[model samples]
Target: MKRNRNFSLLLFVVFLGILFITFSVISVEARKYRVKKSKPHKHQNDRNGNGNRNSPGPAPAPLPHYPTRSTIFDVMSFGAKGDGVSDDSKAIIAAWKAACKVSGATIEIPSNFQFFLKPITLQGPCMPNLVLQIDGTLLAPPNVGSWPKSSLFQWINFKWVQNFTIKGTGIVDGQGYSWWKYSSIYFLQKNSKHIPDMKPTALRFYSSYDVTVRDIKITNSPQCHLKFDSSRGIKVDNITISSPESSPNTDGIHLQNTQDVEIHNSNFGCGDDCVSIQTGCSNVHIHHINCGPGHGISIGGLGKDKTVACVSNIIVEDISIQNSLTGVRIKTWQGGIGSVKNVSFLNVQVSDVKIPIMIDQFYCDKKFCKNQTGAVGIRGVKYDRIIGTYSVQPIHLVCSNEIPCTDVDLIDIQLKPSPGYRGFHQALCWNTYGKSQAPLLPSSIDYCLGKNGDPVKRIEKSHEHVC
Candidate 1:
């Protein structure tokens, strides 16, 4: 009887175990089913935002659809004139206007031909979501004065527009060599009276959102290669800009009064700063860029008159500079009231550069650069992982009198120059107060001796002294 009772007990225990296992498996399967059932609904909600299953077919297709009419050749032929003297700007403008009216149309520039687009402004305070597609060369007028001012600035304002794109495999040649010549001549003559008509930019977008300019070759711009002024949400990718390094004021990209701007995967060889960020600009992220034979990225020469300027929260990373004048710089005038703060540089590589990093607060221009108070001040700057191989010292720091720089940090900065060049170093510092406590050199004695041949111990923590 005891054996029979033990057998019954064992069978009951096994049965209970089996029931628990089955229940656990069913619970897991049910949870998985719930998750699977919710996934599509979640995606649908993301797309529709209101959880409506029937939300207007794929957001009504972006404004410019492919395979549309070729507006440049088919619509505005203008007798295939390759020179800007043909007066095709009116026809081109008309074609652009017509194509823009029709949603999802491509204004194509046919290949194997050059279209000399005289200075013509393509102004658009128009509807959102437009695309300007180019496949042929849009040549600029060889004569600088012949290019109209209206076409350059007033054309294609694009203010308050969204989802605008400019994509092309073709070139927009500014023919800026002549313009540069004129500017030089005008400056040499000191002929302020002539006011040689201002040449329009190659591409200018203002107050626009979600804009993309990609895969285009822009060269020899009379003024700025690209200007983003008072605009937001811009992306410039895979674009190439080139000009003579001596080309006067030919900045690759100039941003002023803007926010949330990103420039990546681009190459710039220009006359001025590859990228210049001026007043009222913030949240700028620039990465994967190759800049050379020009000024690296810069913020200001700021605080002219009472015009307040502030640039903050900028990041420049993964950039390669070759033979540039300065790698990364923040320059402010000697007597202006404004502040530049919260700028960071990371993982930047440099070769053959004059100064890999610089902060010049004593920025004095010709004629009126008197030692003035409140020129501008820099604060909260962080430089990390900056490596370079060059002839000159890799770093320079200068601060102005009266208002000193504050909160500057240099972390993990490894700079080694080529043989027989000045070692990795720092230059003149006046009224500069900050901490560079992290020694980058391999030797502690060398670190104690500042690059300017002064003992680092005397100046390590002082605020008002010049080095």
Candidate 2:
């Protein structure tokens, strides 16, 4: 019995020893993570050389005070009604005028309030570092007839602004139903003598520099949702642009003559192209974009009306286009000059898309599209890692016969036609010279590639580009 008692004591001592060791290790680890000492002398050895490493510390020092910047100009204070019915254009103008003069000022449109505004221009070469912080909803006029001629092109235009940023968690509602009906009627009228100009885009930036627009929800634009014209160093990220699929000319984001633009992590579903990179654009990087129920992103529709369009150094990667008409296309009208070069589209995911890849030189929507000789030069184009399921044609490469595409390279391209469509998927090629280094659907890649002793183009319009 005594021996058993001693055994139990031994066991208990061992368990206690284990627990004590574990707690000691934990204490050591906890001591490793330490806060800075307020009194430096306390970290040193005590007079008797006891472990003073973790002495009873003094109270923590107070946090240093920072200078607060109270340069926020609230739109409500400018006599703007937050109601959805009142016209707040003048109030917005007044607030902008106040904020534009102060350096590093933020013009805030607070949350939960809908400000109804008319067409207005926010002209600025404002003091350094201005921010248009939008937290409330901004609604456009519902009737097109009520709009003036001055607002035909765009509803809200930011002109000549530098070092500007418009961002917030809010909505810019275009109320585009009326404009869509107007455009549809105008386009449908047979033998109509005068075709009025295109409808207004929602937000337009003209001749602006160093602009960043992000985290905003924009919807129902009458024409193009967002347009950046003659701007540089523009960044658009994490925005949602949406409209009905049947709406006409409602492009999500359009960039013309803009340079150094980065558009990433955005979702778009509009009538027209999700992102339209037009003529005179350069150094554009677009990635992580999700587009659907709309025309996929495109470069050109350029060279229209026999004009010169020069674009270069563009990259589009990691894009997904679902249920769209076209994906990753470059289109230019006939009878034009200049070139599109050094462009790359990589890591594209296409699902239920009509045309997965296209480069057209005869891009026209007019009923009587004039066929001409002059064409835009296309060179140094690359398509890589483009894997998709095409609903219609897998590929369409219709370059200009006069100025054939050159140095075009395709690699890692795997496409298959979607089920329920047994139309014998095709890849049509005309006047397009390119090297395909990857496998394609149906194993008939020679049709779209001027390789494997394929005939060089002279001039044959047997199959015009399928839009």
Candidate 3:
């Protein structure tokens, strides 16, 4: 019985020990829960309070301070009034000065503005890729009296610039009416040499490289609408040039001593040659042009004043000429010394043109030019796929007797006489040596035939010239 009582006491003590261990575990868990409830998450504390649990979140990474892809220098920001009457030349010059220092800079002339600019030459050896974005109209001073005597040669001139671009759908209006009137009266005089040369070209690039002028409309120029002289790597596209049909000497684009030129997809309605290729020009490609009411593309009047000239590698293709004086003509003065070689005219369509294809070596512009013996050599000229109607003649190839044209080729030419044309459809050829591939429509050039009236074979001539 005593043994059983001792066992019961030991069992009661074991039960009490088990109850105490369970209470201690529950108390420790409660303390842990209280501590967790008192503390807040780090992110939540950072949002609700100034400091983080340890320190404030690092200050937001400062935004990078650098120029955008292309920095712009707007003319308006340079104090341009933009009113038609105000002089904006100063503002434009300021913008260009700022842009010239930075590479890949664009000088922006904003839209809805008519800026009257004086005769100015923007000279540059600027940072690469300088751009002139002309979204507004740039007007030359209206009155001729406003121009200084020295500035009458060019209205807007770009000189010595490289990798430059002038673009945007804007109008460059040379208010040339006053100058034209003065010129008309001056030309009527018997001896006009005394009259100072007053007409100014609308736009000119001199000694600039890799220049591009596109998407611009130039109108009513006193002289040439656009000119590149002593420049290289020129590209002119998608531009419109216009003037009165009787406006004299307003060639659409005049190239002199410029090489590696490309002029395409442009429309021209002017008084003079739509494109005038002067001396020292080569590797030129002119295509997809619309020309009318003007003299068609011309290569010369080169070697004037008994000077030496050289031109080569010219290709004019896919052209449309309507109501033009002549189509695809190369003219050189009588006394010039040069070699014009490797010129091709392909796929040209004409409507009411005076002469569809011509090469006039004895081209005399004045009333009377004294006959001279020396001439510019014309060789390797090809006219292929020339089709349409001509008002005066189908073909007139009058080369120089001194240096006759050689290796000329005509293939697939179909030029019909225009309606109401009573003259005979004849092709005139003199001092030209060439062969016709297929039978020319309307009339065949008998000059390209042998004495027995058969197509003559071309004799390869030596083309080395001193010029």
Best by lDDT: 3
Candidate 2 lDDT by residue in tens digits, 1-467 = 99999999999999999999999999887776554333455446566553354565455679999998568999999999989999999999999999899899999999999999999999988998999999999999998778887678999999999999999999999999988887777867845644445688999999999999999999999999999999999999999999999999899999999999999999999998999999889999999999998889899898888777888899999999999989999999998777788999999999988888899889989878878987877877898888878887888889876777766787878888887755447678787776877565546764567752223332221122211
Off by over 4 Å in 2: 1-69, 190-196, 422-424, 451-467
Compute the lDDT for candidate 1.
0.72
Candidate 3 structure quality by residue, lDDT tens digits, 32-126: 99988656554564543734456555466689999666479999999999898999998999989889999999999888999999998898999
Which candidate has the highest TM-score of all? Answer: 3
Pairs that collide in candidate 3 are: none
Instruction: Quote the lDDT for 168 in model 3.
Output: 93
TM-score against truth, every candidate? 0.74, 0.81, 0.83
Q: Please identify which of the two predictions, 2 or 3, would achieve the higher TM-score against the true structure.
A: 3
Error of 3 at 33 (Å): 34
Off by over 4 Å in 3: 1-70, 190-195, 446-464
